[model samples]
Target: MFESLKKKFSRTSEKLEEELIEEAEAEDNLQEESGSRFSFFSFGRKTDEKKEEEVVEEEENLLPEAEEIEEVPEAEEVEEIPEVEDEEIEEEPKEEKKSRFWHRNKDKDEPAEEAEDEEIEEEPKEEKKSRFWSRNKDKDEDEEDVSADGEAKGGIFSFVREKTIQEKHVEDILFELEMELLQGDVAMEVATEVVENVKENLVGKKIKRSNDITEYTYYALKDAVEEIISIPGKSMTEMIEEKKAQGEPLVVMFVGINGTGKTTTIGKLANYYLKKGYTPVIAASDTFRAGAIEQVTYHADNVGVKIIKHQKGSDPAAVAYDAVEHARAQGKELVLIDTAGRMQTNTNLMDEMKKIKRVSNPDLVIFVGDAITGNDATEQARKFNDAIDIDGVILTKADADSKGGASLSIGYVIQKPIMFLGVGQGYDDIMEYDPEWMLNQLFSEDEEIVENEA
Candidate 1:
């Protein structure tokens, strides 16, 4: 029956999923671009380092080798060298000058050769060690930089990283959903509360896969609705049993505006309890409205239950009081009081309804609302509750209510449980309200698809 509301919720989930997935994809693309830029710079720097290393290695290779000193002549060559020197002695000044030059050259060559040998031994070793250390240090630094970059960009396995839902990702989508809910006849506060609850549940949640988005969205919506419909209180059946155990009838008064099937719902309840082995008496307490007494009497007669009713223009409160006394005297297990339908703004009728409540002192006051009225039903329930604290609700014409706004919001807005739903026109058409059933109706995949097709 809640086709419109169901579609709204389903569309909201889908929209949120699409928005989040799009955001995630965009982020992945941005990170990929960043990683590509980083890789490009890294490649360029490596190429420059390779070129510099090549130049250094080439320079090292072209360095001249240490010069070898000439070995001294053998003993025979040494004697010939002495004879040559004696011949050169004829030019004594020239000989002395040449000998001194040779001695000076020999003395300088020895230290230069030793220094050259030390340089050859230590310089290449030191240079190679320095180059090796510098290369290793640079390699380590590069590795660290790449590691940091990878982490910052979500690494090579970026797809495995979970996406955390953010407020920004869902804000606009939720706002739209709220507007749709309001348009669907959901009460303003109820719509706002649902949106806030969903946001609280979704924001900061982590999703590991694409399917997770759908799953999380579904549950978030489901939970919010569940909380909205789950009013903490005893069911009507429980109250009946409790009162029955105490050997007293359960007094339940039904109140609502006109044309909400209030009297029909009362007849339904009477038949319902009658079948359950409880004798229920109907009280025609709506003596103000024309034909109200006859209408209630018809239902009571049709259901074969005793009705304590008064003539039109009589006191509704006195009628209710007499009905309660009749139930007590007859030892009936249930009392269903039907009050005249009155607009909440009508002070005289509202006060008269309150007088009935005061005189009857019903164990449970039920608000009968037309599910088709949507937000109007909710507002009526609120005003009725303010006048005389209603204990529960009965949503009539629920089977025809496709929008389902009143059914979803009435209980939550008034802080009362919806005790029953009138699904059809038969005397047995009413069924006890079930929160789980409503949830399933909204979230079941097959049902959703079927409704969409219709």
Candidate 2:
């Protein structure tokens, strides 16, 4: 039932329904005054026998037996306002030739002056009718479809406004949003938070619109993401500077399950240091993936950073030893040792990753996780953090995940600052993380989340 209600929000349909209901109620009210005549049947009344027969047929079918129509004789000076006459009203303008009553004599077309007086007197009533109909043609604006203090849904079905929204429509919009989020495989909590916040922002305002709603939604999402990544954790540069200032070369290690892009991130990290005027030396410590050594070597050569490698199937610790000696001799500022992307599920591999850390003695141990794997990334972070101390997280392929739930929730789960992001598959795919900008984009729609929470 909840899901069913969610897909029914149609802005065009809302407007159309409001107009229709008002029209129906107005028609019913007018019919009450006219006695048994639908407003539509008011025009084209005729005294002709054929017309009388047709009216009788319609009256028989529609008129309720509980109410009987009785017509009192018209008073000489007082009578209900004559109904609008389609043909007669138009002919009434030419009152100078009053042949309205045909007596089969010349007196039929004789008096035009009296007819003119009657027409003049009826003019004001006609003007009043015209004004009333014109004014009532539009739906009532005072019905109060949506209000912040009111119920989600109210007196009217599918009611909403630029200021307030119907409860059903809110459900509809939020449900659709939730499905989209889940289909993108966002974390369940992430999806729930988005739906909850979106509803809070959407109600008491016109969503499915541009203006404030669109901007509000974007900002709301941006803010949530920003909050997630905006941990007051230290950065790679800060860590490196702290280490170097204390007369210690910063050693950083990367860890994750196989095929999680751990080694690629290591190359990128090495590339980052080389550009920072810090000659970074990399260790091909990942012996699992066949192309791991060559991958680091390729990026290492391309970045003008040398990598320490050994023959395939060689012990990873051996390469780490050579890499550390090389960095120490060159007086390098940072040592980024790429460890095997081994599954933490395998106890032996987890032990190896731990042993490698002891051998390398890295200052920062970052777990490179895939953003597309959703909560699995969180579990991987936890597992790696348990196996070996994880200091921070480096989320790769961030832009690839559309829902972006992983990027947002990972920081909270892991309790670490996301140092960098891999946006695309370029050599310069890595970029400095922007917590504030990301938060703003996500929570841009939420004034409360962006301003009040700040």
Candidate 3:
């Protein structure tokens, strides 16, 4: 009897479960269609219990079936409705996994340490990159016109090459050249320009041999000389002929700083005149210096020429006047007056030289100059030219160490021909100063052997 009650009770519960599910599904469907006032989950527990008791009562009163109903399979009893796993299940697992991973990885901080290490390494790299770019920016700009600018290129190499004085020792070469130019009395502008030009040429050059350096210096120096001395001047023969055609016995004079061979030049000129068959009469007007007259007299005797003499401290103008007078009386073709060697800038002495020229009324006034006076020689030539309108230059001491370097300036400024040269101490030392010969002497590489041949 108890077993039958339990069976009735289990069947009643199963029927109630099915009815509740169906009712809930119907209510859900009705809500979707009619916009229902209440949800299916709002069903009360007391109403559901009452429905269960009624289902049990109806099950017991049901008549016995004539035909048996096929039993539902066991698999169908747990009807799989997508084997529903909650989406929240996945969310919970993801959250649990994240927390567990964080807890486990907390002790293994190698990833964070590696990231810090990467940052530290990157900091120095960035700094080094900034420095490298900063240093090479200027060189990069220079290399933009690489064909034209042969300078240090970009990078640490350029800095090292330029600052460290490692560009084939160019800095040393330029430094030494600067010092040498200063000692040579080169003008600051000229010297600096030369250095700049040469530096521009050599900035990026890779000169490896001594010969290249030597050639470079040679060209640089040669170019400077050419720049200063490019002007052409009057020749001594041209001046003489021009004056001689105008009149007989043109008066040629010598002027220079003392000990610049002014007196000796007068003698050499007389000898040169004798060779030209011009009857030369020497004027002994340099009475101020001891042996000035006697020295000229000795040259006169050797060259077999006539000379006019006066006592010491005599008026030079009077001596010149007498010499001119003697030339006219004897039909002497040329009169070379030996004047006193005085500072060309001295006012009184320059006045005296002017007076001598005025009284003599010379057809041509030849300015005998020293070729080895260097820069001062240019100044001397200018002073002498300003004094008496110098007709030509007789550059003496051409064989000296200075090698007529001053001729370029003197000749260029005077715009007159160089007439003669005093190459040595003797008579044969006196030779016609040829322009081409002088150019060779000035620019040539061969050693000039200047003995006292005269």
Candidate 4:
């Protein structure tokens, strides 16, 4: 039934999710750009430092070779070569004599040479093993350092990290939703409250994934609506039972503006109670309006319930009192007082309605409103509640109301529960108001299934 309102809520959630995701993506892109720039500059600086170190090492190696060349003797020392030659000539004969002895022991020296070669190979093998072990240890240590650093710095996967919802992210979206609600015939106060509640629920929350944005938004909107509709009060059936236990009828007074289906609502209520096995007496107290008494009487007869009615121009308060007396005498469980439909500005009619309340001392005062009237119904309910404290609300023609502004705003405006919804023209068309049902209608994807289940 609430097609327009449902669409508004759905759009708001989607828009908010989109806005937040966009902002998160923008921030991540900025971070990536800044990170890339920093890495590029650092790499260039490290390359320059390595080149300078290599140049210094080349100059040091050339200095040592030049010093060794300068230390060698020149050709001017030729005379000293004669003494060196005589020493070489005398050592040659000694070398020839020893050569014969060396030739004989060469076979024995071959074993030693083989052993020396084996030792040389073994030394390289040990060195290679140590180098491999050292390289592996260094690699493992580097890996550990990288992991520790990743944990502390959010790592390369920082772009996918959870985003915390900020005020700026939702401020514009919530404002838009508030304006849309107002345009949809929602009361300004109700719209403002919904926005504030949603903002409070969403801000500072962490969204771990893209899907979490939608989930969070849905719950935030649902919770705000739930709070607005959940007015604390006893239901009519409970009141009836309470009074019934005390051997008295539960008196209920109905008030509303003109042509909002007040009489028909009363008739429907009469039939509803009659079917419930409760002996209900209807009070035709709407004597100001022409045919009001007759209309109520017709319903009373049709529903097979007793009706206490007066002639035209009779005191409505007196009629209500008579009906309550009748219910008490007959041991009826309910007294439904139907009052004249009057505008909130009609002082005379308002005073008269108040008199009916004083005389009847109703256990509950209900404001019946037309759901199609939207904000007008909400305003009327507020005025009536200010005039007389209404215990609850009943919205008529709810099935025909596509906007559903009144159903959403009336109870919240008056701080009263919407006890029932008048869905159709038949006597059994009314159903008790359920907040969960309203939520399902607004948020469920399968509206037809939800309606059927409801």
Candidate 5:
């Protein structure tokens, strides 16, 4: 289904992831330098504190020497005093000694108090330094917490912005992705939409600890593709059954450009209903082509179903009217009408198609397309839909298309459900369309089983 797209995206992811990891590593190196600078600042502050403590210790050692010099001078003064004033001098010395005793005690108390005050001041300084380091640690921890929070916010579908994904890298990736899509045959508008979606998803988003950048990118790609192809509509079988319940034979008109297997798809559709136990009638309204009637008649004979057709150059609308009338008379449950293949730009042919649609009043107008034609098929589908307002689509040659971009873009571009796929060349080669199944075929790998299935 989308095998080519998957391989292309896988290569892109590997390339993008390699670049992002390199950038992240460079950022980590810068962070390491910042951490080293903070450590150096802390070391310098510790050295300054050590020098101040050494100065304080030297001042304490000088205090005792200065006190001894003062004591020697006081002793000499007592010896020089005369006998007449010996008693007074002795009393003076005693008074001096008493004052010295009181002064020494006060000096002793001052040293103890100064030491106590220094210890008190040093405790707060140590506490302040501890708080400074603690704050730095807390800041680092907070950064980690924020990254975790961002991952939580993104959950499984998106990524939250915490650590910025480099915009330059994203732009580069988008450019490469666009080129790849174009090379794979995706329409230009669809390619641009895909790139925009991926950019919106990944730019500025935080990379989770448990996830990789490549993972985020892959999610965005898958989401964008599924959104593009998954048009909201009723299931094919359900619509058919609903129309059947109305008690009128369900008429489906198939339209497409030449060589798109429109006639073969109608035959397959008729065979499909026959297996389901419903009477089917084939209408060969492609009477303009040389062997269109013979082609449809061959399918009718192979499937053992009734066919309403006319000679070449007959009115296609008249052929459709006869087919519906025959179905109602035969109590048939389904009518598969094959119209002539013509280019959408052919005004005359387009008008003829409109007449057939008006005359038949088909319950469903289906546009058959070739998956191998890629953008050409999509453009044709758009033109046909614009002209005749098709209800759904049936894509032929799906198995042969390696790129398969048309199948991915048609439904989204035209806002129509793709009802079936022509996988091979047989009446039983057709399969009901399943969006999930298509996705699985595109993305499923052993390593990505669940996500690819999704």
Candidate 6:
């Protein structure tokens, strides 16, 4: 199925595994560093204590000099007593001001110097012990919390082996996945959505301690792929049969650029309906291109269905209108209209396609694209859908496409279901699209390795 896509995704998975391993090792290193930081912090506290002791000694030495300065003179003591009493009264307000300053700025200038000195000498031991214990305690709590994220608080050798996918790690993996998708020719919008979906599934998710990181990654990626390809209630065959059951012929119009196997897919579709017992009529409305009528005619003959056509360069809208009327008149169950192949950038051709769509009002407007076209096929489908409002897609040459970008992204980009895939040149090679089947193919490692070896 998606062998090429499988390889691409496998490479991405390998990269993810490598990154996870690196992150686990880094976590182990971080834990070790935390222990070393604890030791350093303890040694630093002792050094700070020693410095505090030296500062205390310096303060004590300065005390005697300070007292000498206070010995103003005993002779003047009596005369200064009355002045001292006045000074004391006046100095009370100054002391009050110094007290306020000390509180405001924790100053040690005057009024609170003794108190500040006493506090300084006594507080460091308690402060250091408290700080040291609290820091290590918080570190322990953080390690415990880190364990909750995916890795348990393991011993030095065990942490690296017990890595888990964290939110941060998921972001890194998504970035890498996006790059890989782009490289694999997945469209930017599709790639972005895929990664976003993966992120939503992975972020904040706590894996069981016994679970491997790769298991979570695999689920996230599988969910993402399934999401990208899924379009609920948009099955083309069901819609076609619904219209048929409503007593109307199911008219399906195919549109895409040249060489996308539009005609071949039309033949395959007719064969598909024929086997289901639905009478089909092929409409050769692609009159603009040389030999387009002959091509559809050959397919009609090969599929054993009647074909309607006009000469070269006939109005395609008229052809579609006539074909639908023919199918209705003949009581046919299906009408597969093959339109001319033209580049999506060609405005005249796009307008022509839109006119055909308006005229026929097909039950399903299918955009046929080459799966081998890679990213360009997605853009082609988008433009075609914009012009004609395509109901679904039928990818051709899928087996030849090693990258499988178009198959993976066309539906996501255009918001349409991929109805079928043309696996090979044989008319019977086509098959219905199944998202689950595709995902299974993508995630299959054995198949991927075998295909890669080939």
The numbered model that scores best in lDDT is 1
- The candidate 4 region of ten consecutive residues with least summed lDDT is 33-42
Cα RMSD of predicted structure 2: 24.1
Off by over 4 Å in 1: 28-160, 450-454
Predict model 1's lDDT versus the native.
0.79
What value does the lDDT take at residue 374 in candidate 4?
A: 93
What global local distance difference test value does model 2 have?
0.61
lDDT of 2 by residue, 1-454 (tens): 1111111212222332344345445544211121111111111112134668988999888866434433233453245545565567777667745554344355555578668888899986554344332322223321222122211112222112323344554575567666765665556676676567656654565432222332343344434444445688777888878877876778888888778777777777777777777878888888767887888888788777878899888988878878888877888878888887777799998888878888888888888999878778877887888777698888888876755656766776667777888877765788877776554333222222211111
Please write out the lDDT profile of model 5 over residues 1-454, one tens digit for every residue: 5667877776666566556645655556211111111111122234446879999999999899889889999999989978888677568778888999999889877887888888888885454334422222444332332221121111111123224576787888789889988888888888999889988887877763214565676677777887877887776567667867887788889999989998888888888889988888988899898988998899889989999988899999999999999988877888888999999989999999999999999989999999998999999999999999999999999999889789888888888999899999989999988887776566544323212211
Flag the better candidate by TM-score, 4 or 5: 4
RMSD values for the candidates in order, in angstroms, are: 31.8, 24.1, 47.7, 30.5, 28.6, 25.5
**Regions of candidate 3 where Cα sits further than 4 Å from its true position:** 1-179, 185-224, 364-373, 402-408, 413-417, 446-454
Superposed model 5: Cα runs more than 4 Å off: 29-163, 208-211, 446-454
Whole-model lDDT per candidate: 0.79, 0.61, 0.57, 0.77, 0.75, 0.72
- In model 1, what lDDT does residue 240 have? 84
Question: Given candidate 2, what's the lDDT at residue 224?
Answer: 42
lDDT per residue for candidate 1 within 237-302, as digits (tens), equals 788899879988899999999999999999999999899888999889888888889998999999
Please report how far candidate 4 places residue 418 from its true position, in Å: 1.2
Which order, best to worst by lDDT? Answer: 1, 4, 5, 6, 2, 3
Per-residue lDDT of 372 in model 5: 95
- Model 6 clash pairs? none
Worst 10 residues of 3 by lDDT: 445-454
4 or 6: which has the higher lDDT? 4
